[model samples]
Target: MKDFPAQYDLQDEDVLYFPHIPKTAGMTFRTILEDQFHNDDVCPATLNAQLKDYSQADYEKYRLFRGHINYVDIPQILSHKHLLLVTVLREPVARVISHYEYIRRMPGDPHYDMVKDMTLEEFAQGMPVGRLGKNVQTYYIAKLAQFDLNHLSPDEVFDLAKKQLDRLAFVGILERFQDSLFLLSYIFGWKPIINTRRENAAKDKKSKEEIPPSTIELIKQNSLLDIDLYQYAKELFETRFAEMQRDLLTKYGAFTHPQTVKEPMSSQVTQELLERHAEQRFLNLNPDISNSLSYDFVEPLRGTGWHRRESLNDRSGYRWIGPETSATLDFPVASDEDVIIEIKTICNYATTPDVAASLTLDVNGHPVQLEILYSDRGSSVRWFRAIVPKVALDNGRVFSRLTFRVNRVVSFTEVNPLNPDPRVVGIAVNSLKIFPVHAAKTESAALSVFELKSWRDVATFLEKHLGPGDKIAAPLVFQLKLPNEVLDYQTAFLSKVDFQWLILYKGTIENLNPILFNLLIHRFSPVFADGNFVVFTRQKQLPKLSFLALHVRALYEDRIKVPIKLYIIRQLKQIKSLFVRRSKQAETD
Candidate 1:
């Protein structure tokens, strides 16, 4: 493609060349790719004459050079920059049909007048559109090898096309459009600003099934070489896509295990504040602000998997995700900081416990931790909170994808026999909000359950936490079992806390509970104080523990004005038994 080195060479190849073959969804690709660069950085070269307006200097300035330009003409047009080529192809017969329909709809196409009165059959048989009417996808690829198709045999032409197709940066299939965009992001390291709008669709075009079999056959006869080329491209696309998926799944682990979203940011007042402060971060689906956001952050990319926005009672807008296992949102991060993402959704179809739907979120191939902040199964509404740590985000990217995969999808018909709606639904998403988790270093504290592994770790912590006069308030030590991965993100979340953080260890309850209780009181002594306390034990003891009484006492003491939250880890049976025995003994005492 572009006569570059065998390997993808970026030293001189600063430009991305997209050859827009007609009716292959190339315009959509152009729209998305152009968003990755500045407006002036994209060449205005849709035709040979448009190429004359730009000098070599002008070509060098543009990062993306795309248009309905011929493959052979690209090298001379973009002579200054070596190119990385990308294109999309559709099924040959379908593309031919779309081409004819598009010509009939658009008055601007060169063959529009000629094709205005032509029937689908007449267009298929007449083949008046020259190279584009027959095996156009192959025609583009085959031209890369030889300028003159007149010299090559039919098999020779097909073989040449296949060889060049292997060398291009990417070739997307229009049928698998969403997957193609997802793969494009991964392969090119682009955070896609996904626009799902299909530009220039041929309105009122009949479905392929409606076309007569003889007419379809006629189109197929002319597209034989394109069909072969498309098959090869399809197989190649699948192989490459599979390899990408395996690499990602292997690296990120299976999404079968779901971590609940812990900090759901759904309070109307807080949401309003965030919207007022950083309006760009809020994407209100009711108003459909995805397209209006300046940076275009956190918008749904694949339009196929989602139903149109609909209102339910007082809720003005919510969209149902279905038919696909995953729904992807574009997330553009401004820096390498942790981000808080909140989504309001309803899993209505998953009415029964056996059919409960669980969701997992991932960013740039790394899974983030999620916890449910609020849920009312009776109302069928749940608020999900996800903390995408800096480690998972690619800072300063045009956008990173936030992909949500559900464990199962249930159809309305499957849920109830009388229901006629058979669409397999994932979740009904109401709204999505994303903002950076700011680290307010001035107002912060560190409440560690266990001592860090070494002095080096302690030093690292001190370097991150301590300012000029700050002292490590004699390590309020206790032991709690938690995965180090969980510890890392959780503590990062707590690093900038202005409120009290009380850590409880169930194993040494008798020895530590009094001390923790007293500390909790002291921390809550301020007239207006609010905080979060975490219980890290091996079991589900929060419900049965004597410490529950102490926690209740702290709230009733009239010394605290704000709410205190309790976050507990899930329990093991053995730990539960031990905590139960301890509670009984404490009661007896």
Candidate 2:
């Protein structure tokens, strides 16, 4: 295997795709490779299976029968014939998150909820020993340890990744998945799949409540190792990607498609006539004729005002642009009247902060009121919150331009903040929408409803809600909805429809969810009710949610709710006192 690169044009040989196990990267790599070498003189085999299997006499004969064999091995498999040894490495935080998600969805696994009770460190340590399960945690631990990060320091993960690259014809990063796929295809003489979609993509459900910050911090600290690996892999892949692009341009001479004959057919020509003749081709072979244009064809067109052609700028009208109309507002606040304005901010950064927006209100056409409100931020590129005020925007003099300014400065600098420099100050009158607040009748009504039953129920609910024109919120809508007492349980009965909906929404492996976003990752087939829509999960086989519930119970001793404990304790005391009084009255009688 070491000498394989010497005989073959390593650049032209089939790729040895080795995505670290448990990373959805493998699934993507496999799918792309399958598409690329659909009929090439190369055979693809999984490294998940031991090399001993291929070394057997029968395996050798089988390869001889097939005419070509390319074995994909992890950790040590390297050869000159291997055009590329690509592995997608995710951030340690992301990897662990994915691992947790994987374990959560395992069938008949009772220890899944145990993750909630243990620290990430304890979880990582227990992973290698299969405390969760011999089948689930052990496999992930082996895959994670394959890089030898355990023996080396955190910084060494990068070095190990670099060393792995030294053995590879090319290395691809998981972060820039499409770019990596293009690079792999170019390097390995493989045809890229034009429109491959993810195999199993999870649906985006809106969650009203936010996860605790400590949990997020724990995840980050635990996945520090992966973070190192990701940084290294990203840097390596970017460098390689640029080099590969340069090499392709230099070798292929600007990368254009060969010209094709476009003969105009008469409008009267019948469809039957075109299909009847085998020699006649209807569609142009060069679908991307625009991209492959020569300098001669493009240069003259630019000066002739022909740049306005739709093909030249395909993305011209793709975005929404607000109308140029503007509106002005004037407000006067009395000494007793305090004005309040609500603003929403989009947090597109790595760290969530208590961001505050500043406002400049003008009284008598002079700057007067300057106020700020602390806003909670979330981790996604888009974060929104409604600001409620104890006072209204009524001020003095009946009319003055009120300007709202945003303090662009972020609180934390260690991690990337979504909006490093905010543009709008205080509150923009246009952005603010005023609404009167109504007091809730009861505390229970204020809480968001989350019912956890079985995967079946979840799936059914999803199919019904999701349709052609509906929009779902992100950070996921579904909560495990564990019983309050068993907050630590990994396994819980998921509504069947919810499970089915998740499977259908999340497509193939090609479009796997980002590790940070996915809470559960399992392989299963998706079934459709209307015979049109489909749903599936990561599990290959469908297991009953009840069987999985046993594991849920084991992992979480009782379900937990944020306010349930306090409410229940108070109610219990009231019941006890009532019983005591009733007994005293009975004794007196």
Candidate 3:
């Protein structure tokens, strides 16, 4: 008997009812399946004989078979395409406790004496715990032990249940027994039949036998894995049930018993059915358009400035603007014409004396006249804007570079300063806009800008765009250089960027290691000169300058970073002063 592999050998027409937990209801469900489908003249002897054979088998051996069926080892009896596997999941703890009580009360069982006399706590403690072990304790503990025991975590079990449901065709919650039965019947193309047993028949059992609060809490804590599984199942059931109800209502005003006196189909109902058929026909006729018209950001930096240049000098200072910068700007065209160049210096420091300086722009041994458009000095820093016109260039379609020569050196005393790192003054051209006037027709094109949201969003967005098999190239715009830690946490999801940055910065400060955060704040601080001009560059393009100006108000309303808000508000006040000074200066000029 042990060597012989038992086979149900169900035909295509026959329904196979595999119940994991056997009880009177299980038996009755099986009987109903046989009675409803098995026509007397067609195949009466076949099913009867199978039932008798199953009954004659040893109960212990059959129980083992039943246990193995629920596991992954079950033979794939139903073809993958045809099979519609269904299961009913009870609350694990309750199921285990109920099973323990039933087994303990059984007549003449070997473990009956031991279990009957012992408390549940003692029996549970004595059992060899974990998955594949029998329920000797409360249901919750037994479930935990069975799936993970000491090895796997509760979260893992929850994940596993989700995976299992995804792998299988159907799963049903025992709490919604009738609804589950209806779904099962619909899928199998059978008439719905409810099994009447002690549990199902006893409608007031829930009110009568209220589970203890302590037991429920234990179940909730111990079977956290199952709680997640139950929530997911419940959500799926609700969504699908709602859709089913809508379909039924649309087809037949309201769903009624099929056996009841049939109402004549209305003309309106027939028209609705025809309309549905026509819609489906239209859908079938049209080719799916989603695949086309989808736009993706493509890599545009190939053979561009981002490519590594072997001969380029990696100097760390206020280096002279050379051929590389000129090459990037597509500057100084042919026909011996001079080009005008402008430079803007933005500084943020208080108590810094304002200084005046002269700068010269030269192209191919030709001098150009320079003019100061704007100049402001403050306690912290000074901002200067100078423009040079009509620099000479070489003949006929050759690109010539314009170089700036500083004549007078201006120095300022850094006093009452925030003492941001890299006190060494340097110049950064944030952007260059070129307007070409071809005779009377003038055209303008500006460089594309890429703004990072939070450091995290940048990382994740980059990973998805840059990952293998993805064709996205780095944005042609300027890139922000961030710390390695900032990049690490933000590389997976867009939504977590700001949160990750905040958490990392907060953690660093809380742990008394403020060096990194402080360094970042100082380097990225807003630069304002004498409460006149505010100038700053961000790694990402900000959405609205006004929002940044109202930083404090926005932070309270929109809940942005405190440091960021402070910086914006301080900058805005200085910018207002700068606007007033500029208006006065223009009038004098």
Candidate 4:
């Protein structure tokens, strides 16, 4: 699909409409919603034939409407304006193959007898150009947007399909089942579940190697629209997931410095009391064993944030939080001297390093902070420690409720193909322990800082902050040699929300002109400026736009340092603004 830049705001009160595109995990989801949740307010339909039979009362009676319903006709049946549409999309080729296998397995179906002997290749070639077979997903999406597909071209259909998808509350990935379910949980405030079985699962599914190249190509050629649509959905999912993740990080991710609250033992102790503990070699060999416990070593995963086990494994009862999932532990905090929890986690990022998961320590039902886990290069063990403020504990309580949620997990089977393991193994946390930091008093107030000196440092810093959306102008170095020499001129660049660097260079107002500067072979022409404090405005109709408007300021010119510092500060501010805007945009969208 040609990129649809606009996104629709998925609002509350919109009808939860699930258009069950056949073979795209629809059966599995239906079983869970219908079989498992018998009391849920739902209007159900498993096949296309049932859609035409729905009445106005059917729409008004249920909160959830599930079917292999035509997207275009749902509105007409509903007699409503808003719909919180949701669906799962699969790989185009895999979906086609699954559709073929499912039809063959259905003995009661009318087409079953005729297609029992048909080869996958034959089926791919013979499947019609309508909503049931080739490019079926895209057809339904297009039909929903335009009410009919006959008037539009193939590319137009793709465009409309994407436009409709953007408005959806959630578009789940069939492969990223756990993660998708978590997104649904996060978006809808549903109790996220992980213990469900895969109902109506397909068996002996053929791999790409087993499918002939011609048959695969035939499917791909006919359903190119589905491929593009799937790709767009994937990107949208990642963006939305990342945005939600950042929120979780903000909500639960906290890093607290040493005692802002008055410490219980840091007060003055009387000389008489001190004499009572004097002179003995106080050899407490097994120190406070009662207070300290490790998650991996002894505690089974059976507490607050822990999900029930699906099938027992050697994993010591740990559940697969392949999505945004949480686990809770109760830690003893006797006297609140200082609560230190050390978490031992092992994860293999050999697969999707970019697709990392975040862990947030939630204390007393409040999210304290989140920590992101990413591999430096390969799979490895990570050690995380959360220091709970004594204030986190309830009045005179010995135990505190600690919940750990792996806020975000993204899986990419296509891009990196680097991680081939099927199950989205985020992080297998082995142990969580509560112990005193023996040197708690020695904890410093100052945070560790990285000082950038050389080009390499600058490069690293820039890489950490800036992405492709940003643009930087050279520092506006104006060494105005006045009639009388005076370095009294002051200058500082103010930060803007967009990723922009207004690098001002040496020149007077009248002498200003647009000079072309190239970055990675892309040409950028600086906006014409009159003088210092000149209002640089882009007319509402400028074709090309970049965030490079800057004010000229000439301070003591070192040539080596000032410009770089200015650029760095400008870039940093821009990055922060970009994140903020993105966060707000995500909430609305």
| Candidate 3 lDDT, 194-254, residue by residue in tens | 4332222222223214656665455445445545665666676655544444543455443
Instruction: Summarize candidate 4's per-residue lDDT along 1-589 as a digit string, tens digits.
Output: 1132222323344566677887887866653443212223456565567756776776576666676766437766664656567788998889888888888999986678767898887777677765445788888767666676787788888898899888777788988776675556455433333434454668679788898898889888878889999999999887765664554434323322222312221112211111111111111222342545544422322233332233223433234444445555544455445565656554434324333336667777655643221111222544455666656655333346677766454453543576563444344565565665453223211101112133223224334434455443332111111111111112111232232333332332111222212121233333333332222222232233233333222211223245558789999999999999999999999
Which candidate number has the best lDDT?
A: 1
Write down the RMSD of all candidates, one decimal each. Answer: 18.9, 27.4, 31.4, 27.6
Q: How many clashing residue pairs, candidate 3?
A: 20
TM-score of decoy 2? 0.33
Model 1: weakest 10-residue lDDT segment is 440-449
| Higher-ranked by TM-score: 1 or 2 | 1
- Residue 197 in model 2: lDDT: 36
Residue-level lDDT tens digits of model 1 in 505-556: 2221122333434544444221111122223222222232333355444533
- Ordered from best to worst lDDT, the candidate numbers read 1, 4, 2, 3
TM-score of each: 0.46, 0.33, 0.31, 0.43
Best by TM-score: 1
Q: How many backbone clashes does every candidate have?
A: 7, 92, 20, 15
lDDT of each: 0.56, 0.34, 0.33, 0.51
Identify the runs in model 1 with alpha carbons over 4 angstroms from their true place.
1-12, 77-80, 128-130, 148-150, 192-195, 254-589
The TM-score that candidate 1 achieves is 0.46
Clashes of 1: 7
